[model samples]
Target: KLKDAHCAILVVKMKRTLIMFSFILLQLLLGNSLSPKHSSPKPNAEVTVMGFVYCDVCSNNSFTRHSYFMSGVEVRIVCRFKAASSRTNEMITFSANRTTNEFGLYKVAITSLDCADVDSLASSCQAKILSTTRNEKLVDRL
Candidate 1:
């Protein structure tokens, strides 16, 4: 009879733990859903964007002609998607701004949450040179 009572007590404790855990989980879900930044997004898949920043030490019109691979430059990656609505097109965009690594490379990882309506398409995303960390001196021919 004592053994049976102990087993019954154990079962009750286990049930209470499970119920409490579930309630906490539900509350977290509700809290997340209430926030605009924490929108619903499927997990397990991610998008990584990477690039390098270089300085044209010499005056050059070609991309590969740049002399120096500049570091410490701030880069931004913007992903956008457009859909037609009524008469105008609606745009959805996500942006990640980060500085470059030691190798002058910048990486931006966009999860489904980061990309609201955008996809991992070449046309849907873009990167532009914002500004350099420091101003460079110019030389004039005498």
Candidate 2:
């Protein structure tokens, strides 16, 4: 009778351990599935440049309360990227013309296999207002 009792106690302990292990495994799977996933940009992915065109009404070289966004403005975007590796003497250039939307926002998409990472974009990209179709119909070059 003592041996039977011992076996019963061992069986109960085993069942408890199995239940705890199953709970822990279920928690791990659920946590992994519910967690937000962070994705890094893949190589050769398209890069977009976006900005707003605003008229500096005060001419202080900055936006003020009097300033307003200009729609239907023609903008030219140019980007030049050097080769990722210094061993290769390769340069990629991207140029596109885009018109500002009603919100005075312009977006240019550039896709190239030779594109450098985002860190190098600041030094390699340029955008300028090619023309403005406001009431004055002024054309400016930069």
- Best-fitting candidate, measured by lDDT? 2
Clash count per candidate: 0, 0
Q: Give me the displacement of residue 72 in model 1, in angstroms.
A: 0.7
Candidate number achieving the greatest TM-score relative to the actual structure: 2
- Kindly list the per-residue Cα lDDT of model 2 for residues 49-93, writing each as its tens digit: 887888876666676788777889989888877657767757777
List residue ranges in candidate 1 displaced over 4 A.
Answer: 1-44, 63-66, 82-90, 113-120, 136-142
TM-score of each model, in listed order: 0.49, 0.59
Candidate 1, residue 33: CA error in Å? 32
Candidate 1 per-residue lDDT over residues 1-142, each given as its tens digit? 9999999999999999999999999999998888679556556445677777665566563345445566777777887765323454667677888777786788887665433334424477777666676665211110
- Supply the global lDDT for candidate 2: 0.76
